[model samples]
Every structure is written in structure tokens, then in C-alpha cells.
Target: MAARLLIGVLAVSGLGLALSLVAGTVLLRDYLYGRVAEQVSGLSQAPDVRPGAIAPSRLCEVTDAPAVLPSDFRLTVIEADGSVRCRVPGDQTGPPVPSVDELRDWADDDAAAVVRDDSGSWATSVDAFDQPGRDGGKGYVMVAISLRNADLTVQRVAVGGAAIGVVVLAVLALAGRMVIRIGLRPLTDVREAAREIRHGDLSARVPPGKPGTEVADLSTALNSMLEEIQRGFEKRRESEQRIRQFATDASHELRTPLTSIKGYAQLYAQMAARNTGSDAGTSIAREARKDVEQRRAEVVSRIDSEADRMSGIVEDLLLLARLDQQPELVKERVDLVEIAHDVLTAARAGHPERRLDLKVEGPVEVEGDPGRLQQVVANLVTNAIVHTPSAIVVAAATTDGVAVLEVRDDGPGMPAEVQHRIFDRFYRADVGRSRRSGGSGLGLSIVRALVEAHGGSLECVSSVARGSTFTVTLPRAS
Candidate 1:
């Protein structure tokens, strides 16, 4: 761009210089011609060049021409009768005289004239000089000066103009380059920042540019967008990590009950095979039958128990997957108070040793799937019962447009960090307790999912040794 600008400027300058040279040369030529004409007009009035009275050769002697003129000047005398005489006829390089027709034309008009011939250009002036004898006779004087000096002067001016124009163009090009560099500096910084970002450096930012300029606004906007993208990228990475961990935990939990059931089934098959062995004595067969029947009953019972545990784990996993993929639950107005009561009753039956309390100040109703809502309450109550030996309290109330429910426990509370991840899939506050008590570690995670699917949110507040409270807030049905 700088180069183009410089070229444009030089082009215009060259054109201007050419025009100036032509104009200056033309004007100078005219001025020199006028000066020569004036000198000729003055010398024509001299008394020495009077009509027929002076002989042609004597005219040059009387005029004192060399004293009054430049070295290059030449004079021509024309008599009234049409004869021509030259002062410097022997100087072949001198200026030429006017033609015969030119002299005749000058005689009739008696005015100054300019004529051109093979020799050079001449400035001529003619007027009637005083007649010396007879009727006044017509005479003429023509003075010619060569234009060589003016041509030389114009040539010198052109060369100087060219040199000056080159200097001016050079200076302009350098200045233009400096200005462009300064203007593009901000953009250069932006380009470098973008390159860094491309290489995974989201923290890179362009330095501030001139305020109120387009470049400044662009930089600010770009930085803001990069910050948001970096934040999102970090969040996504965390989510991916959690998902991977969830899968591993889920596999481990499912494997435990399956392993138990497989062991029980294998034991039953071994016992039955031993009891079926061929025996010769009836007494021995009878005795083996009694023992085998008793052992088979016990083994079957154990297998059924493991099967129940495995079934529960499978059901919980399916529900979670369903909630994640498609949470299109049947929405209806369900009473939170009713769900809380039912969940507490079920929990109390399953955990008879754990004390459970239910408090319903008022009937709190929300729009959600009743079955899923009940599951939410059940999961929370079960979670409380499994994790702690202390009393569990279930509460429900309504205020304004919100339905609130909480299941809290007076058991050993959790740390702040543990509380934060309690609702993550397959996360357990007490891993040892989860394994021993046959807890799937998905209860709270499923609770959160179900609540969120109903356009509600669940939060847990806990402190070490202070107990933990799990709160659910739902939009009340209007």
C-alpha cells in the first residue's frame, strides 16, 4: 500500500514537472523574441538607415551595430526597390534574413513581424525612414537573435526539477511506510494473539488499542469471547471426568450383587449334585434326602436375596439412564406432603432401628410426575437412613409459588468437599458404608436428576459433625 501511494504521488509530480517545463520554455522563448523585436524597432528609427540616401554597405558602418547588440544578432537591410543587404553575410552560422515576400508584406503594413526560415527564427520591424532625396523611399530593418541560450536555460531547469521531484518522492515514500506501520501495529498484536489461541493458549489476549477505535472494540470483544470459551472448555472437561468415574463406580456396584448371586447359585448346584449321587441303601438315601432338602432351601434363600439386591441395582441404573436421555415424565399436581409421608413409612419399615420423623406444616403441591416425585423422596430418605445411625427428619411446606421438602439426618455430617459431589452419579459420602449396607450410591444422584427433570432443584448443606440437610425446591402448581 505504501509503495502504491508513493508511485501515485510520483506519477502526478512527473506530469506536473513536464507541464511546467513546457510552459516555462515557451514563455521564455516569447520573452526573448519580444526583447529582440524591441531592439530592432529602436534601431530601425536610427537616422543612419534613412531611405535611399545611404549606400547599402555604408548602412552597416553608420549603425555602430556591434556596440548596441549581442554577439549573435544579425541585421538585414531592404531597399525600397526590393534588393537585400546583410550585415554579417560572411558569418554562415548567424541568424537568417526575412524572405522577399516577407519584406514586401512588411512594406505595406509598416508593422513589426516575426519570420521563420531554414537558418533560424528572426524578429523584424519596418517603418518609413526619412527620405534623403526624391519622393520618400520605403526601407526596412530586420533583426534576428538565435534562441539557443533560452533552450539551454530551459534544459537546465528541467534537470533540476527532475532531481527535486525524485527527492520529494523518496521522502514521501519513507514517511508513508512509517505511518502504515504505526497504524497496523494493533492489528499485528491481534494476529499474534489469535495464533496463540489456535495453539491452545486461551489465556492469550491482545493488548489494548486506541480507545473508541474499531480495533479496540474488536480486541475487547475477542478477549471476552475467549474467556467464555475457556470457561466452558474447563467445565466440559470436569464433566467428562465425572462421567468416566461414574461409569467405573457403577460397574463396581453392579458387579458385587452379581458376584454374590452367582456364588449362591453355584453352591446350590453343587449341593444338589452331591445329594443326587447313586446310593445302594434306602436308609442312606432317605438320610441324604433330608439333608439335601434342608441345604437346598437355605441356598435358594441366599440366591433370592442376592437376586433382589442385583435387581435393585439394575433398576436404579436404568432409571438414571432414562432420566439423562429422555426425562419426559408425566406431569401432574402431586402433594409433596403425601410423598414425604409415604417415603418415610417405607424407610422406617426397611430400617426399623433408625428413628424417622415426618413434619408437614401444610399441604405443599407441585407440578411433576407423581411416581418420579415419590421416587425422589424415597431415594433421599433411604440415603439418610443408610449413611447415618442418627434420627432422620422429613419436612414439607409451601410458600408463595414454591414447594419445599427436606430430608435431614442427625448422623455424622460430611465435609464441604464431600457435600459438593454428593449428587454426582455413583458418588458416596461413605464408601465403606455404601458397600456394607448394599447401598447403590446412586440414590442421591437419582434424586437430583428426578427433581431437576420436574423443573426443580436439589441442594445439600452439610458440615462435619453438624449433620447434613438435603433440600428440594419445586415450582408450586398454580
Candidate 2:
């Protein structure tokens, strides 16, 4: 592209230079010819010299005869019969005089004509005069100047101008190429970045260009677009991973309950079959039947419990799906402090031995679905209670047009790595404990989703052995 542009620049410049040279040469040639013609015309008007004044057959040496005549001027006297009567500056010769027809043609128009011969080119003019002492006799005086110097001057100017134009064009081409390369450096960077991206380097970026230029703006815009694309790809990858994990977790969760239910059902069936074949009146058989009935009842209760647990997990999964799809909520102004008090009250009643405290700074009112908001608070409180066996504090306050709810516990805090995935669905800090305690690991995930759905944010700050604090911030009601 740069080469083509430079070529185009040179082409246009060369054309202009060529036209200028032609025009200048033509104008200079015309001016030079006009000066020569003026000199010839002036000389032709000089005083007429009679033929008797000069000796016949001897050149009339009029070198100093007239101050108006230049040294290179050639003067000639022509007779009516096309003969040279005299010559001026006698040593100047070989440019023979004009013929009678040419002299008559010049005499008729009172104009000058260019005459060329072996000596050189000349500007010649002629005028007719009446010859003294000759009846009905006419003669012509011809005046001329050489054009060698003028022609040489025009030639030198044309050649010099052409050479200068070529040098200037070459310089322009070199400079233009360098400038174009510098100007297009940003685009080269962008191309390299794109190549890297195509090779799977998502972090590549174009170098910035000169500020306020089109190239700079383009570079900035391209960098922004690349960033968005990279982010989109990363998000897609994370989502896929999460989806796979969710499926695996769901299958494992359902499998455990199903396995237990199936085992108990099979045991109950074996017990019933054995009891059906026994003697009803025998004491040993009656005792055996009574023990089997009790065992069967226990087995049936266990199966029902497992089924309920499985059903709860399924319900939680469906709720998450709905929330992920942006479920509609009944949003209204509600006091977060009131919600916090209720959640803490329930937590205290459930775990009466645990120390639970409620701190309300003000009536923290926010716009949100009351039921979902209550669930969000309950989940956070429950998560804290399950993980930490220390004093738990549930706080509510309002500041800066936002309502803040916090659940804090004085127990072993989570590590940074754990905190990062703490809110991921089915991610348990203690998997065995979580499962044994009937935790599906969806508490924090649901809490986060519910908070976000109400235009709120959830954040956790934790360090190993430093205790953890979960804070939820929602926009205050207007």
C-alpha cells in the first residue's frame, strides 16, 4: 500500500513537472524570438544608405557607422534583381542575403521572418527604398540578428529544470515512504495482535498510536473489541465447566438416596416373604413376625426420608434453574432489619445452644421480593451456623442509598481458594460433613442469586482461622 501511494505521488508530480517544463520552454522561446524581432524591426527603420555612397564590388565596412546596430547585426542591401549590393560589419558572411521574392513578401507585410543558413538562424526584416539617380528603380535594405545564444539559453534552462524536477521527485518518494511506514506502524501492531489471537493468545493487544489520530482511535477500538471477545470466550468456558460439574453433582446426590431407598425396599420385601411362609400360632414365629414388622416399619421410614431428601435436592435444582433464567419476583419496599431479626430469631430457636446476636443500626429499607429476601437472609445465617460453632452476628444497616446486611461468625474462616468457589452451586467446603448434615451445597449459591435478582451484590471476606463475614448490599427503597 505504501509503495503504491508513493508511486502515485511521484507520477502526479512528474506529470506536473513535465507540463511546466514544456510551458516554460515555449514561453522563453517566444520571448527570445520577440526580442530578436524587435531589434530587426528597429534596425530596418534606420536611415537609408544610398547605393552610390558605397563603392561597388567592395564591401561597405559599416562596423562603426551606427551606434544603434549591435556587433552581431548583419545588414544587407538587395537590388531589384535579387543581388547583394552591400554588406555591414564586412567580416560577417556566409548567411547570404534574402531573395527578391522573400524581400518582397517581408516588404508587403512590414514584418520580420526567421531565415536559416549554414552559418546559423537569423531574424530578418526588409524595407523597400527608392534608389537615387535611377528612374523607376527600387531597392531593399535587409536587417537581421543571430539567434544562436537565445536558443542555447532556452536549451540549458529546459535541461536544468528537468534534472531538478527528477531529483525533487526522488526525494519526495523516499520521504513519503518513510512517513507512510511510520504512520502505518499501529496497523502492523494490530495485525500481529490478530495473528497471535488466531494462534490462541487472548492477551495480545495492539500498541497505542499517536494520540488524536485516526490510527490511534482505530487501535483503541480494536483493543476494546478484542478484550470483549476474550472475556466472552472465558465466560463460555467457565459456564461449560460449571454445567458439567452441576450435572455430576446432581447425579451423585440423586444416586445416594436412590441406592438407600432401593436397599431398604429389597430388605423389606425379603422380610415380608419370610414372614408370609412362617407359622402364625407358634411363639417363635410370632416373635419373629413382630421383630420383622418393626424392622420393616423402620425401613419404610428411612426410605420415605431419603425420598424427601432427594425431592428437596430436585426442588433446589429447579429453583436455581428458574433464578438463572431471571425469574420474576414480587418486588416491594421491605425492611432488611426486620428480615434480619426474623432470620436470627429462627436460627436461635433452631440452635438454642449456639450464641446468635442481631444488631440493627436503623430501619434498612430496600426494594426486593420479601420472600426471596427472607430466603437470602435465612441461607446466609444457616450457612454461618453450619460452618461456624461460635457466636454469630446478623447485622442490618443503611448508608449511601444502599441497605447492607451482614452475617458474621467468630469461627475458623475459609481459605482464599475456598472463598473463591464458595458461592458456586453444589460446592461444599466440607463435602462429607455437608452431605451428612443434609446440605445440598446450594445455600450460598441461592443466597447470591436471590440477592443479585433484587439488584443487590453479595461479597465474602474470609481468611484461614480469621473467621468469615458475608455482606449483602441492596439499593435502598426510594
Task: Give the winner by lDDT.
Answer: 2
TM-score for each candidate, following the candidate numbering: 0.76, 0.80
RMSD of each: 5.1, 4.4
Candidate 2 lDDT, tens digit per residue, 344-367?
Answer: 888888899999989888799988
lDDT of candidate 1 over 243-361, digit per residue (tens) = 89877887888787788888878988898788778473799788888888898899888888878887888898888889888657898889989888887777778878878999888
Off by over 4 Å in 1: 1-59, 62-66, 70-84, 87-153, 228-232, 278-299, 325-328, 429-434
